[model samples]
Target: MVFTREKTLDRAELEAYWKEAPATLEGHPIKVLSGYGPHEVWEGESTEGVVIAEFPSMEAARAWYHSPAYQKAREHRVKGAVYRGILVEGTTPQD
Candidate 1:
């Protein structure tokens, strides 16, 4: 998921969201490829933070996002920052 925050209305709320997010993925396999740092936009515009998480499958990713715990945590994000997010299926290269 990629998020672009146009404005941060509440830092405390955003922090709370992050604090609660990890518990939601307790049993799910997740890999963080990149995020939570400064980045240079080589092409189009970008947000303050960019996160890429690799899950076992698309379904798992979807479940995690839709789970009740996450749903609650998401409320904080909604109130914290102006953002845009998306989920894209990845492709595996074949020989």
Candidate 2:
């Protein structure tokens, strides 16, 4: 969930979101090894930031998204920026 820096979210809060993200899955299925954010939106109607996550499986990913723990964090997320996510299944190269 990318929390655009609206009038509510400040730099410190965004930083806190980064710090607390690890606790979302408690270092189990979720792994966000590296992330970069808060870049200038030199486009049409872009958010203030972006966050990416990798999960062990699609089910795991969905679970984490709906989990109550993450839901609480989601509150902070909603106020922070534009929330967007997708559960996509990977595929091998076509033969």
Candidate 3:
């Protein structure tokens, strides 16, 4: 998830998004590789926050993303900030 806050439209809403998203993710086999923290833009423009979550498989990742609980939390995010998000499968090393 990559978030670029044009403006905090609603602090309360954003807070709710933050609070509810993780709770919804509980029990999922996901590993948070990176999340809200300091980062350097080596090239192009960067967003305010970048989050990378690793799952056992693409199906699992999609399941988490589209889950009803997460979709509810996502409502707050949509109302609160400008962002871009995508899911990409990682490449494995060649033998």
What is the TM-score of each predicted model, taking all chains together? 0.84, 0.63, 0.84
Identify the candidate with maximal lDDT.
1
Candidate 2: tens digits of C-alpha lDDT, residues 46-87:
654455666778888878888777777776666655455656
Question: In model 2, which range of ten residues has the least summed lDDT?
Answer: 1-10
| Residue pairs with clashing backbones, model 2 | 3-81, 4-81
lDDT of 1 by residue, 1-95 (tens): 55566578899999998899888878877787776667777886666777778887889888888889889999999998887777878877899
Better of 2 and 3 by lDDT: 3
What value does the lDDT take at residue 92 in candidate 2?
Answer: 78
- RMSD in Å for all candidates: 2.2, 4.0, 2.4
The whole-model C-alpha lDDT of candidate 2 against the native structure comes to 0.61
Clash pairs, candidate 3, are none
Candidate 2 contains a number of clashing pairs equal to 2
lDDT of each: 0.81, 0.61, 0.79
Stronger candidate by TM-score (2 vs 3): 3
Clashes of each: 0, 2, 0
